[model samples]
Target: MIKREGYLIKAGLLFFFIFLEILSGRTIFLISSFSFFTTCVLSRQPIRQGRAMKISHQTVVNRIIVVAGLLFSLSEAYAAALLPDKQQKVNQEAINPEYYQGLSPEEAYQWFRDAFSESRKSTELFVLPETEEEISKRATIFNENLQRIIKENAESVSKGESLRLGITAHADLTQEEFQNRYLTLQLPAKRPEVLPELKGLELQQRLSALPDSFDWRDKGVITSPRNQWFCGSCWAFSGTEAVESFHAIHNNMTVTALSVQQVLDCTPKQDGCKGAWPGVVMDYSKTDGICPESCYRHYYSMELSCKKQLIDKCPTHIKVGGYASVPQGDDKALQVTLLKQPVSVSMEASSFWFQFYLTGVFKASHCHTPAKIDHAMLLVGYGRDSHGEAFWLIKNNWGSWWGQKGYVKVQKDKVNTCGISSFAIYPTSI
Candidate 1:
């Protein structure tokens, strides 16, 4: 019979205690990882039958503790190598290069996951790496982007600047691809051949009756933030949200989220996710009205075949006379329209300033060329800035992870900063 002694007694007792703790504790995986099967080491003295003998239980337990400590230290060191020195802070739910430097492959992937929350099913669609080579390439790209942005932002900061850079999800794509994907704005038929400019006197007169401050979002007229994902259906979102707000205010009912998927899928006038004209979207709303988001809420970034059957079972429709054009190049007219309801406006959102706009009323002098009004967004409210400068509060469909939680405030006095006032329009109720 084997008699328990020395190392055996100590190890058995230690394991027994650990077992009890495991029975009564949290994080069983951590505790269980420490656990291992029985093992023996010979004492200085030989055992019975001239063979080496069992270890002292104390020695066994001590050895295990030592090994466990070594493993823990190694784990921490490895993690330190992969992760950033520290998690950097930001105004939004974004991860900038300032947050970390020299991140490993795992860390880079984790960073993307942390900020963008890209699903496992959709991993193949994004720039996530698979092979070892791919991982290295991705890490290099990630760091390059971070360093570039950080350096540029530092220069911007030195100038006593008002805007800052951000590491948006679109940071990975080339500017050309990004523009094509995100800003798919094509003018819809039959509005105007030319948008004439106006003087401030005319603007002041048009906006004379407007309130000093107004925000449809503040008044519960807008929906919660939404993400367009890989889809360029901001046109769909822009028009639908305006319709949503109009229905709420028009019917004197509680504001509810409406479906852009209806317009994305059912409308023949505009392409589904490739891009859409908000004007056509408004026309769709004016004719068919829109389904509530509750009735049909599937916004995979990919476009699908139009489903008229789903439109048949829609929940609510806002009866509208037709789409009304807000005089282009008129901020005051846009403001007047906003005071009553949010307007669907087209703008050139494909600029670096827009991609990384943290806060402050964005100025037009920031960019090189006036980009085409490539994307559409809702002009929800207007108010003076902290310094008494006026700004337009606009809603975005890129989800709350971006800009002021899926919204932006640009300088209002400038008639065409990113072409905000150049292509403004709203739906009129019947």
Candidate 2:
């Protein structure tokens, strides 16, 4: 009977092992399988042919407690490795079809308010329409945006397109309002007299060997997405983030969030909050160099005095050698450069479709134009989506609440979707 019991336990464990094998690569799978295997070992000690193997109730409870503790530790360690900054879990349903499906204008507005409220509960980063008048106006605008989203999704389905549209936090505001407040990328009046020379032959050699997909984030060198928040300082954020990546890649240092406030405060020849080009900001960092967040903090477009006295005293984290500008409208060139490091690029982000974009390869050709780039973002990676649509994964300055946890995948196209290929730039030697 004892021998038969051992066979039964072994058989059960074999089935459990098979179950865990199906979930093989995940952290939970390893943790759970190990815990169960350990429990089995503790519960079923070597039994002499005549004597029954026994595990005390207290011992079993103690073993379970130990296993639970081990599981928690392993899970936390895995999570930390993947997300250093500890980002909050994204509520993907907010952008999902089922979340807004079949809701009327009023109901949709309520859903929007509830979504923001829930987000605020966790992050306190969003504000709701408090006054009755404000609430009514926002509801009306949200209704209009919702209609556009519905129409766009319908058009996408009819055209058999992979592109999708959904309501975002900006849905409560008109496109004009969003543009005036958020879309801020302005070119310098005069270009840099001597543009960085593109090494065409060298780049061509590397292009042939380019991987099917590449992401700097995978290398643990890209920091979490930050919100510019009505700050026309995307130029500063993009410049800062690009510098951070370049420095980490070159020096083999861990990715760190440097101070964008310093860029806004210290960069000369431009109003940091009033909008400036990202390349120029990076050029500024090449000389002055930026400090880490511990030394300076971002105020989200709030006007503040440039704290030069404090910044001067703090340790300079990484000083970039210089920056290079990719040839305008040359996306293939941009792709090769991206393999080396993350690149800074600008796009036209004021259109209704672009403003309310939720997920999927953003392929609205009408809104994209080379001459109309109005926002700055970091081109972190590129790859094909599940449907085989090629896309450029860009990190936006907007908070995690916007677009795929503060990133958007633009459809790779010849026309350059949203002029992403136009005015591309990346930092050089650290």
Candidate 3:
């Protein structure tokens, strides 16, 4: 007895609700069937006296086919939404050892120096040894490792690997020295998704509504990348960067360069050069507020005296209201939080695998497991390649000489690759 118009309106309403429910990560098989049935009912309107509205058998079948096609398309899009594009690709270019093969040991030594042109000018950092024996020893080690690194990349698990084993300030340094300096946090040993019409739809809605990509760098919240040098206080730098980003986002102010020196000089009992927990650094900032870098300079790579007078003397400082730890294994949550501001993060900075990362996403399993977190860096942004591969853009404290301009792209969503998901913490300015 219902009018054809009434049937059409009901069908339309059902379709709308089904759409939202699917977005909330619900299985809409039942809803899909209901929608198809509604369409079928709309198509078979009751016949009138003279003008019989005949819906042939073929027409009903065709309408059902149309509804099925729509449901299938919706299903494809929904799957794409839930299965985030976090895959990584390692470039397969073979190594060019021929360049080094033709050079003599002395020429190779000069080659090393030429490779790092600007570094040699900073003599304090790249000091030439007084003994020729020391110089000869260094050249041998550099050339040996150069070939070894090339061979290792060919067999590495990470695809699209682009590594450069150039002479760094630490080229003459031993393995133990390098490991001691690369400090950061590691992931905890633990590790969900989206809709509007189902249970807990609000949380689901938030997940589905997540933007495909976000970069806090574009928002002017992150400060220029810093260098921790041989100092183990990389954690202090990491925490300070996170605090600055949050302060900028919360207060709508220009990004300020807060002092890692203040954290080093003041955070009681923490070895300034020995490295400390990033959360502990933020805790101190909440209580005492960190001064600007201009006020309390970063001097020694090790812990400095608690220069209470120096901090007290500063006219202005930045403060935060404690810190929050990101869920130990939740990457999507980390990605979501990153959309708001850069986050303070730590992970295993292996001396071997990751020490010479020049370009491309680092997805090596070798860098994931360490005795503990060995270095701290800032999580500034998330990006995807033209091929839909995803990566997390990290800002390191190792000067511009390292990485893609003091930044490295870590693999995203591979169960916390590089310990990125294991230990994440951010401070609040609100």
Give the top-scoring candidate (TM-score). Answer: 2
Output the better candidate (1/3) by lDDT: 1
Give the CA lDDT, 0 to 100, for residue 226 in model 3.
66
Tens digits of per-residue lDDT, candidate 2, 1-430, equal 7667755754565455445444332334455556655655664532213345466786567556545544564564456345413323334566554587788867878887766554332222346768989989999998877777888888988997777776665678888888877777897665432233455676677667878999989999998888776658888888888999988888788888888877887788776667889887778877878888767754435446779887877876568878777776777778888988899888888877677677788874757444478899899999999988899999998777677778899888545677887678888775
Q: Highest lDDT: which candidate? A: 2
* Candidates' RMSD to native: 12.9, 12.5, 23.7
Clashes of 1: 6
Q: What lDDT score is found at residue 123 in candidate 1? A: 19
Off by over 4 Å in 3: 1-102, 113-128, 153-167, 184-203, 298-300, 368-372
lDDT of each: 0.66, 0.73, 0.65
**In lDDT terms, how accurate is model 2?**
0.73
Query: For each candidate, what TM-score against the reference?
Result: 0.71, 0.73, 0.67
Question: Could you tell me the TM-score of candidate 1?
Answer: 0.71
Ordered list by lDDT, greatest first = 2, 1, 3
After superposition of all CA atoms, the RMSD between model 3 and the true structure is 23.7
* Clashing residue pair totals per candidate (backbone < 3 A): 6, 0, 20
